[model samples]
Target chain A: DAGITQSPRHKVTETGTPVTLRCHQTENHRYMYWYRQDPGHGLRLIHYSYGVKDTDKGEVSDGYSVSRSKTEDFLLTLESATSSQTSVYFCAISSGVWQAKPNTFGSGTRLTVV
Target chain B: EDQVTQSPEALRLQEGESSSLNCSYTVSGLRGLFWYRQDPGKGPEFLFTLYSAGEEKEKERLKATITKKESFLHITAPKPEDSATYLCAVLASGSRLTFGEGTQLTVNP
Candidate 1:
């Protein structure tokens, strides 16, 4: 298991409300990513950070935003949650480049928007 | 577009039964292929990373092999504890990965 920790393992929020998930790591990895898992969709990358304050959008970045002020913490925020945003969110950290080493993932956060 | 597809969406096997899971993919340039194991209600655990065709890696009873367009995870004499969903992903010279839906494997004792 990695040293990554995700807060609020399970969450339920009403539609059109703000929601945020936090990911903290102790490994001091240079890369961190947020991904959403849905039935029949596998894992879709939502956003990623190469370093503190350096972020990039992934394939499914719509309606979601992420910020990393320090090397160990990354935050994913849904300004106004929707039913479609309900899914299992996973946070991952990697010490090296994607091709150089495997990413270590934290236990997922199950979110439901009604 | 890069994509990954895993076959046999679900599989059932008896304890000690050896089997394999397949992951087929297409990418403009393959940087690495990764295999992961996920138990219910948990995040995925990394298993192996293959860099190119003809590369192979092994851990305990699990072995991963890769070719140009696909990768295979072979389990030898699996046990009930081996039951989990197997996920495969590909990194195409970028930081992000494209994953497959995964194959859910059930090993009954």
Candidate 2:
């Protein structure tokens, strides 16, 4: 029940096409993250932003990129969509680093690349 | 790498049945352990946060306890609505949360 929302709740795009997912938070949290959820992989972080204009790659950052223009918005972009990139994407926000406080997750965005 | 493993990939309990789920983890310095409930198609809902070994926290029918290397989620008199995937994650020294695969529970009526 956090004040987090993901845009384009659902999207479908062709392979090799560009795709971007948006995460917006009204809480002004300092940390924002993008993760993809797969059946056996659970949730794997693709990218994270600690502050505006600051970003870092996660375990599965390959082919994925993120940008934070402001504290309230985090964007995840897939250079070129691939069938393997199809999964439920979740955006999480935390007031403090995950080590200090638990993060709040958005409902999620389901993306399918055919 | 810091890792978390949850057991009983899937569980089924009849109404009123009691059970427990396990979350085993390996971390350099465990700052905190958290439990979350995620219904299918919905983001996880935070349940409890345990700060240290021998610590325990409870809400309604769910209770969470932590030890040096693992954590336990015990369900009491579970109801049909108590069905969902229970996820466990650890907050390590640097504030990164490494999550477990989760245990999917189904409480039949």
Candidate 3:
């Protein structure tokens, strides 16, 4: 266990509503990432945080935003949820070193935008 | 651009049978290739990492082998419990991981 936890194992929100998903890690790793898994697209990166305040956009990060105010928590928010934003979100943590190690993931959050 | 492609979007095998899954990647400055297993409603679990070509890793009945352009995950006498989606990812000169559409393996008992 990498000591990672994701909130709201399942959620249903109306389109145009705002939704925020939380990813908490017990391990003091320096790297945290958020990804969405869809049936035909596989796993696509949304955003990632390297430190408390260091974040970078991913390929599919146009409609999503992320914040990491502290070391153990990373929050992903969709300002206005859309049906296309519905996906299974996953949280991952990794020990940032020269050569990156494999990341450990949390139980995913399945969000449905209805 | 880093690209990863996995073949046979889905595979069905009888229990105790052995098979292989393929992952081909195109990237510059290849840093690492990773393998993961994911259940129906769960997140991906890390299985192995191959940094260099010719590097191989084994755990239980799964063996992952890597080369310059591709990687292969070989299963030896797989059981029903091993049925799950297998994902392949590669990290190129950056911190991002480019993933291939996973292979859903169904091992029937």
Global Cα RMSD, each model: 1.3, 1.5, 1.5
**Clashing pairs for predicted structure model 1, backbone only:** none
Model 1 alpha-carbon miss at residue B18, Å: 0.6
Q: Write the per-residue lDDT of candidate 3 for residues B63-84, one digit (tens) a residue.
A: 9999999999999999999999
> Across residues A1-114, which tens digit of lDDT does each residue of candidate 3 receive?
459999989999999999999999999999989999998886888998889999989789988999999999999999999999989999888897632643788899999999
Per-candidate TM vs. native? 0.96, 0.95, 0.95
- Candidate 1 accuracy as TM-score: 0.96
DockQ of 1: 0.67
Winner of 1 and 2 under TM-score: 1
lDDT of 1 by residue, B76-103 (tens): 9999999999999998865557899999
Per-residue lDDT of candidate 2, residues A1-114 (tens digit): 568999889999999999999999999899998988899876788888889998998888999999999999999999999999999999988888543443689999999999
Docking class of 3: medium
Q: Give the Å shift of residue B84 in candidate 3.
A: 0.6
| Among all candidates shown, the one with the greatest lDDT | 1
Compute the DockQ of candidate 2.
Answer: 0.65
Superposition error at B19 for model 2 (Å): 0.6
- Ten consecutive residues with minimal summed lDDT in candidate 1 chain A? A94-103
